[model samples]
Target: MLSKVITIAQQKGGTGKTTLAVHLALAFVKYHNLKVVIIDTDPQGSLGKWFMVRSKKNSLNKNLTFKTASLWGAQYESKTFKKDHDIIIIDTPPKIESDARPSIEAADLVLIPMTPSHVDFWATEAIIEIAKKAQKKVLVQINRANQRSKLINKTHEYINSIKVSATNIIIGNRQIYPSSMGEGKTAVEKQKKSKAVEEIKKLSEQILLELK
Candidate 1:
């Protein structure tokens, strides 16, 4: 079967795009026993580094396979590699560059991760417009939410008004995520009860359900 390709993108940087991509890829491999692959399309290559760390420590799971490639590489592979894997998650760059366009175009689903802030909200419009132009399924994931803040509700309303699908999952700010990445471990295994892990797992399940 052809793999479901999901591209995690945000024009604005530091929005947890790579983090979500890495964790979600691992989640699918661990929980569902699916052959998951991650394409590090980002120029920063944060996702590539995470995989490198896992490989060096011999902590990488046999079920999870990842490769680093540019956006052009993704397009080339999409045409040929879709049938070999169960899922391919692409970690896109944080700019509306020439490379990002093709990855977005090749995606079956485009997940835009952002925090609950005015700057992120404003930047989302451009990303959403690009995804819409590509005619892909676009969903917004609210990252780094604070339970006591009203920004989450406001951002949800704003995105809904703009007719974007906002996920019911809200990943809160947690130190365990960064810490787990530093140790080359998935957040779900590092901080089992943290809100971050719960939210990401829910989001992953939702994505799987949607794909089915």
Candidate 2:
């Protein structure tokens, strides 16, 4: 089994950090048949709330596990989870700055999600530097994006200048993402064939390859 810890982090709020965490967790389970555990380090408890909804709906999957921990505590918890789970995803609160180090250090890869905007690009640097300083591999995820927008090219240029790898598969700005979460299901589970599902599957495949 491939045991890896991925920390989804962003210094700015509303970057879809929690959303990415749950989707990736479910995608790994549903599509890759991997044992996945998601640790909610965000005090807002969005991930925990989503899990609660899933449990109430009796829709919980055996391959998926949910836990709560502080960002600092995630490092220790992930080590313990690594023994049994194929992947441990740490969902962190935004604006954590230096406090994000422990989680970053725990991860084999730090997955930073950002929108294709100058504001998001500016906010991404701190987390990226923290991850790079820890000598951990980093993958930047462009989330909730409009692929046709002119800003898309500018986003690529910024990423290139920073010399960090960004995913080829960009997660589009879709209502299905938030709507599916409301039902405690991912887009992949809520719909069999859709653009959202396609993006997630391709992303999971790419991430799994990077982990190997």
Model 1 is weakest, by summed lDDT over 10 consecutive residues, at 188-197
TM-score of candidate 2 versus the correct structure, residues matched by position: 0.99
- Name the lDDT value of residue 209 in candidate 1: 82
Each candidate's lDDT (Cα)? 0.83, 0.94
- Show where candidate 1 strays beyond 4 Å: none
Off by over 4 Å in 2: none
lDDT of 2: 0.94
What would the TM-scores of all predictions be? 0.94, 0.99
- Each prediction's total of clashing residue pairs, residues at least 3 apart in sequence or on different chains, is 0, 0
